[model samples]
Target: MPSKSSARLAALTVAAVCSAASTVVIASPAHADAVRIHDIQGSTRISPYAGQQVTDVAGIVTGVRTYGSSRGFWIQDPSADADPATSEGIFVFTGSTPKVAVGDSVTVSGTVSEYVPGGTSSGNQALTEITRPTITVVSSGNAVPAATVIDARSVPNAYAPAGDPAAKGSINGLTLRPTKYALDYYESLEGMNVQVANTRVVGATDPYTELWVTVKPRENASRHGGAVYGSYASQNTGRLQIQSLGKASDFPDANVGDVLTGTTTGPLDYTQFGGYTLVARELGTLEQGGLERETTRKQRRGELAVATYNVENLDPADGTFDEHAAAIVHNLQSPDILSLEEIQDNNGTKNDGTVGADQTMSKLIDAIVAAGGPRYDWRSVDPVDGEDGGQPGGNIRNVFLFNPQRVSFTDRPGGDATTATGVTKVRGKAALTVSPGRIDPTNAAWEDSRKPLVGEFVFRGRTVFVIANHFASKGGDQSLHAQYQPPTRSSETQRHLQATAVNTFVKQILDTQKNADVVTLGDINDFEFSDTVEILEGDGALWSAIKSLPRSERYSYVYQGNSQTLDQILISPSIRRGCDFEYDSVHINAEFHDQISDHDPQVLRFHP
Candidate 1:
C-alpha cells in the first residue's frame, strides 16, 4: 500500500490533471483555427477541445521541467483574454527533452489529450496536454508575459469545493467557480504566470526544493510564528508552494515564520508532491527568522525528570549524533530517564541481521558524556531480525537511557523481542515479571510496527513503570490539504488497536496497584485530538501531560504550517492527581530548518 504522502501526491496529481481537462473547448476540424493558449486552456478545469486536433496554438515558453516522468515545458500567451476564470498558459508534454528554449515563441500542431499521472486507476485528474507535438519557433527572445498578482486578497477565503466531487460537479464536468473556492481559483489560474508578494513562510524548506508560504496571516495563527493547523473545519486558504526551477542554489533555507520580501514571479504548475507550485524565475529576498535554538530545560531537586524523544532512526553512522547529544544534554536538561525511539541497529540502514543497537547506543552515550552530560546506562530488548518495521533492516526499537547516579534499572530475566511481558503481584503491588519486556509483542496490531518496551526503574527509592512506544505511523492517511473536507484517516485503525492493547495493559497494572507511577511515552505518531490518543486515554485511565500546557504550546511537531502534537507523555491517573508534576514540550527542533530530528522531545518532571 502507498504511504499517506504517496497517496496524497497521487490524488493531487489526478485532481490537477482533471482540473486541466475541464478547460477543453471542443470544435470540429473544419472550424479549427489558430488557437490561443488561453482558449486551449478554457475557463473550466477540463478542456472543451479535449481529444481533438488543434493547429497553430501559440505562446512563449516560460518554464521547463526536464526531470521526472512528466518532462514538459510550460507556455503562456503574452496577450491574454479578459476572463478571470481562464488561464493564459498550458503545459506541453513531450515525454522527453523538448526542442524549445524558455524565451522562444512557439506554435505547434498536435492532438489534445487528457493525461492522468500514475495511471487512471489512481483516480487522479487528467491534465490537458498537447502530445506528440510538431513545434515551430515563431520568434526568439520575445518578452515573457507579465505575471498576474495573487496576494492574500486575490485568493478566496474558502479551501475546497462545498460538497463531494459528484455533488459539486465532477472534476472534468464542473464549470470554473473561482470566486467560491480556493481550489477553483487555483484551477482557473492553472498554467498561468503569477506573482505573490510579501509572503510569510508557513512550512520549513523541504528536501524537494519546495516550501509553503501564506500570502495572508491566518486567523488562527501560531504565536511563535506560522499558521496554526486547525481542526477539520479550518482549511488554510492562502498557503501556496514555491518551487525553484531556475537555480537550486537560489532556494533559501527557511524555517516556519521566516519572511520572503519583494515579488516572486513565475508560472504556476500543478505537481504531485504539492498541488500548485510556482515554478519561479524571479524570487524574493529571504529574511532570516533569527530564531535561536532552545537551551537546557530547568531541573529542580526531588523531581524525577523523564523525557521521550524520537531520535529519527539514530545509529552510529548517522552524522546528527553530536547535535542530538547536545539537544538532549543542553536542551532537554539530561532527564533522569529518557525513552528514546527509532534507535537503529549498529549499522544504520544496512539490512543485515544485526538487530543489536549496542554499538549505536554506546556511541550516543559517549557523545552525550563528551557534550558535558552524565555517563548514561542504556537497556533495550533486541527486536527480531526483520519483525519490527522501520528502515528496511534498521531494526528500530525503543530504548531507555538513564543517569545511573540518579536512577537504577531493575534488571531481571525473560525479556526478548518476541515474548510478551507478564505482570505479577509483588507484596500486593503491580510488578513486571521481567525488568525490560515487550508488551504483547506478538499481537497483530504490532505486526510490522514497533513493540512497546516496558521497564521498571527506581528513582529515589520509588519504582516507576515506563513503557516506551513508537506506534504505527500515519502512513496511509489523507493529507490535510486533500480535496476532501475532513479527510479520511485510514491509518488510525491499526494505531487504535495498538492503543487499546497498551491501555488494557496499563489498566491491569492500575487494577493491582492504584498509585503505580506509570509513564507511557514516545512517538505515538497521532495528534492529541486523534482517536488513537482518545483510545489510549480511555475513561481517564491515562492523561496526556502535554495538555497541561497552553493550547498554543501543546505542539511537539510542525508539518505543513500546522503545529501539532505527535509525541506525547501520558501518565496514569495516579501520576496526574499529584501537585508536583510539571510538563514541558521543549522547543529544540521541529519548527527549525536545521533540525536534527523531525520531532521535539517532551519532558515530564514530577515527584513520584
Candidate 2:
C-alpha cells in the first residue's frame, strides 16, 4: 500500500514545475507580426497559426515552469479578446529553463506548434504551444491575470459535441461551443489560468504527483465521493486532473473522498494520460476523508465463494505479495476459488525464456497461508514464453487458486499453453478435456493476448466449471477525450473476437451438460454495457453478474474519476436461474491512494 498507479499518466505534467527567468532579444523575420495570445490558440482545438513564426506575442507570465524537458512559462493576455471561444493564454516551450518571472510582460517569438502528448498514436488531443522561442520582457511587476473560477456553474453538463465527419469524426477542427459542451468549455480555456475552489477529490493521488477532482460534486456522484461513468453520454464533465508545480515528494497523498480545502489555482493544460490537467502553481490543503478499505463478508456454510483479482502484472520482483495475500485473505475472505490475473513467470520479467510461474505461484501461496488464510493449491497453463503480451519479458497469465479443504480440482492432463481444451461428457456430466487448460489458445483471437484458462472443480460433490480470462487490453484505442468525438475503439475488435471465442466454448460446455455450473470471470477490459459484454451474453449463454448490482455499484475499476466496470463475473443459465448468488466488487484497492493493484477484486458466492 505504498505505491500508487502512475496510471499511465506519468506524462500528465512531467515538466510542469520549476523556476528561473531572463530576457531575450531576437532577430525578427518579416513574417513575425505582433499578435494576441488568442491568435495562437484559435477557436478550434488546433491552432490556425501552426508552423508560422509570430513575434511580439505579449502576455503577463502567469506561471513559470522550469521542470522536466518541456520547460517553459504560461502567459495570459490581460487585455482579453471579445471571443469567448478563443483562449487568452498559451504555453511557451523553452527546451531549457526560462529566463523570466511571473507578472513579466514577455513577448515570445517562436514557431506556433501543436504538440500531441504521447505522440500522434496516443489519441491525446494536441496541445497548442510556442516552441523554440525568443523571449522579450515588455515590462516587469505587472499583475497576473485573474484565474477564471471553474465550479459546477462554469462547466456545461453536456460532455462534447459530435466530431466533424470530414475529419473522420475528429473534433479538433470543429469550432468551440464553450457554453454548451464541457469538452469545448475546457478547450476554450486551454492554457488559460483557471481555478477550482474547495473541490472534492474523486481520484486518489498517484506516484506522478497528480490527483483528480470534480467541480460538480453531485454529478452521478458515488456515495464514496468518486464520479460514476455510466455511459458515453455521462463522461462526468466535472472531473478534471490536478497536478502541481512542485516536487513529487511535497505533493499531497490523497485518497478518494478526500477534500482539497482551498482555491487550487493553475493553468489549464492538456496531458497525455488524463486529458485536461490543471498544472497548479499553488495547491490547496488536503483534508483526509478517513476512507478505509472494504472487506467482503465470508461465504455461508452452504455456499462457495469465488473471486477474480488482477494483481497488476505481479511478479517475484514486486514487494506486493504480502499486501496482495492480505487482500485475498482479509478483504476477500479467502474465496473458495480465486482466479488471479497477471501472474508473471518465475524470473519476473527477466526474459531468459522462462515460462513457468512455479516460483511466483508458490510465493503468493506462502504469503496467503502466512496471512491466516487456508493453504491453497493452484492450477495454470504455462503460456508459450512471451506469446502472452504484457510487460515485454513478463510471461503473465491467469492462475486459479482453490482451497483443497473446500473444493477439489479435477486435474485432467494434456493441458499446455498451445493446446485448446474441450468439453467432454463424463457419465452424463460436463468435464474439461484437460483441467486447468487453455481455451482456444491457438485461435488468432488470443494472439498477443492472455488466453482464457478453464478449469473443473468439485464443490460439495457437485461439478463446476470456471473460465478465467484477461482479454486484450484497450491499449490502441483512442482516449475518451481524444480529438475524435466518440473516440475510436480499435482495440475492441480483438476483445470482441475473444468474447465470441469464449462464448462458443461456454456453449460447448452447456451443450455437454445442460445444468453445468459455469462462472466466466476476469478483467474484461470493457464496460458492462459494451458490445463485448453483449457478445459474451449472446443468445443468453451467459449473464454478467455485475448487472445485478445497481448502476452506481457495478464498478470494479476507477480511471480518471469514473468508477467503472472493467472486471466482471458472468454465469451460465444454471447459476442465473437460481438468482440466489451474492456478488461483491470488493472496494479495497482502486479507491485508496496507496493501492496494491489498480483493480478491485470481485467476489461471487452461491451454492453449486
Candidate 3:
C-alpha cells in the first residue's frame, strides 16, 4: 500500500495531467535498475534522458513544493559526481503533495520530461522534471546533500554565451559551462539546494511573494542601496530571485537597498515569472536600511519647475486618482508645468469612439485641487482611435498641465491631431507655427505609438519648448531568463526610428535659434546608455540632464534586479551652456512595492 503522502501526490498528479496539455507523452516504465539523478539531469539545459522511462532514481528529498500548479519535490544525490557542470539534483513533478518528506531516501520509477512552465508561448527554457512517478521510500530521515554556496565570487562575471540561432543555438542548446557564464552557472545548480547570504535587495518585495537580491553590490550602487540600471551590457551577474515557501505573512516587505542577512537556504527552481529562483524554506532576516520615501522637491523664485510623470495608464474609472494627485502636489512640489503620459480617454478602457480625455483630465485636476494643489490648465492632441498603441480604446496620449499663475501656454492656431508642427524663424527667434502641436503623427516610426506632443510655454517672460513623449515600450523583447545568450532586442528597432524623428525635429528648432530652450522629457522607455538615447543625444544637440547627477542617483525605474533610468529629460545646448539647471528624481514610487506608478517622476528646475 502507498503511504498517505504518496497517494495524495498521485491523485493530484493525475488531475494536473488531465488539465495541462503536456507536450511530452509518457513512455512505458523501464526495468527497476538504479539511475543516478545526475544521469537524468544531464549537463545541458535539455535533459539527455528526457521522454525516456527511468526506474529507481535514488536520492534524498531536499525540498518539496506542496502547493501551486507545478507541485513537486527536489531530490539531490548524497554523493555528487565529479563533473561540476552536471547538476546532482532534479525535480519530480508529482503535481501534488508527493508523499515524501525532506531527508527521506527515495527511489522511484517515472518518465523523464522537459516541462516548460506556462507552455511554449512564454519563451522560457524547459525545466527537466520526472513525471508519472512511482515512489518507493527506501528509508526515512536520510541526510540531505550539503548546499552549494552562491555568492559574487561563485557566479561567473559573464552574462550569456554568444548567439547562434541556426541550430537552435548558443546557451539554449550548449552544454553547461558553469565557470564561463552566469546563465550556465545557474543552470548547473538547477534543483540543487543552495544558500545566499549577506545580499542587498535589488527589487522590492512584490505582490507575488517574491523579491530580488544581488550577492555583491552592482556597478553604480545607489547610496540608498539599489543597483543602478545601465544597459543590457551590464547583465546584473550576481542577481537572484527569492521566494518564501512559508506563509505570505512570514515574508518581509523590504525595499531596494535593504539587506537580507544570515542565510536563506532553498532549492533553486526555474520559475515562470522570474528565471532562476531560490524557493527558500528558511529565509534570512530582512535588515532595514533606513530607506525612507523622498518628499516633494522645493520650488524657488525665478525658477521654472517642470516635471514628467507616467501615470501608468490613468483613466476616469481608475481608483488611484487621489494617490497620484497627492504625489504630484505633495511629492513633486506642484511644478509650474507638468507633462503627463498614459492619460486614457474619458470612458477609461471603454472601446467606444471616444478619443477625448477631457473627462479623465478633469477628474485628475479635480482630485489635485481637492488635495490642495493649484488649479491648472491642460493641453493635448488626441491620437486617432486605436492607432496609438496601449490599452485598446484607451487612446493614451501625452498631455500638459500648467499653473496659469506661473506659466502660460503660447497658443498659435491650426494645431490638430494629424497636423505635424513646423518650426519657423520668427524675428531672430525659434518659434512653433502652432503651440501644443503633434510632431509627425503620420510617421511610420510612430505607428501604433504615442506621437510627441510639443508645447511652447511662456515662463517668466521666456519661451520654453517642452515635448511630452511616451515612446514605444520594450514589449515582445527577449527576457533576461531567455534560452538565448544576450537575447535579441527586436523591440528597439521602432524606438530607434522614433528617436531619430524626434532628434530631427529638435535639430530644426536649433537651426532656427541656437539659444532656443528646448526640453524633451517623458518616458523614453530605454536606458540612458541605450542606442535609442544616443540617437536623441546626437552631435551634442541635446543633453540627458539625468547624467548630470551622480551615477548612483540616476535611476527612475526598477525591473528584475536592475535599477535603471527609463524616464529622462533631455535639454538643448542652450540650457546646458547656462549650467544653472537643478534636477530631482523623486523616489516615491519605483523603489517601493506599493507604488502608484512603476516609474519615478523627474523634475527639472531652471531659471530661463
Task: State which candidate has the highest TM-score.
Answer: 2
Candidate whose lDDT is highest:
2
Q: Report backbone clashes per prediction.
A: 28, 4, 4
Clashing pairs in 3: 5-99, 6-99, 229-563, 296-331
What C-alpha lDDT, on a 0 to 100 scale, does residue 557 get in candidate 1?
A: 80
Candidate 3 C-alpha lDDT tens digits along 1-608: 00122333443454335213544343544443577888877888887777777889988998988877777789888898999988988888886777989999998788788776545554667777888889999898877788999998989888878756775544656878899988889989998999999888989987767899998785457867877766677778888999977888899998998899999998998865678999997899999887777875578989999999999888999999999999989999899999999899998668988999999999999999999999989999978898888877789899999999899999988888889999998789999988889898899998989999999999888999999989998866667878765676778999999999999999999999888999999999988889999999899988889998887889998878788898999999888886899988889888987877888999999888
> Native-vs-model 1 lDDT?
0.80
lDDT values for all models:
0.80, 0.87, 0.84
Pairs that clash in candidate 2: 21-99, 21-100, 22-99, 22-100
Candidate 2 Cα deviation (angstroms), residue 57:
1.0
Off by over 4 Å in 2: 1-32
- What are the per-residue Cα lDDT tens digits for candidate 2 across 512-608? 8888999999999999899999999889889999889877777887888888889999999899886989889899988888988989999999988
Q: Runs in model 1 with CA error above 4 Å?
A: 1-44, 48-51, 66-69, 78-83, 113-127, 162-174, 483-486
lDDT of 1 by residue, 1-608 (tens): 11234345554454433323333344456434688877877876667677677888999998777765566788888887888788888888776878788899999787776665434433334556777688899888878888878877788887766435563324445666788878778878788888999888877886667788888776457666766654555667787899876667779998878888899988887654556778887889999777666664567778899999988888888898899898888899999999999999999778879988999999999999999999999989999997888877888899999999899999989899888887789988889988799999999999899999999999888989999999988765555444434456777999999999999999988988888999999999988877899999999889888888876677888766667889999998878985568888887788787778888899999988
User: Judged by lDDT relative to the true structure, which candidate is superior, 1 or 2?
Assistant: 2
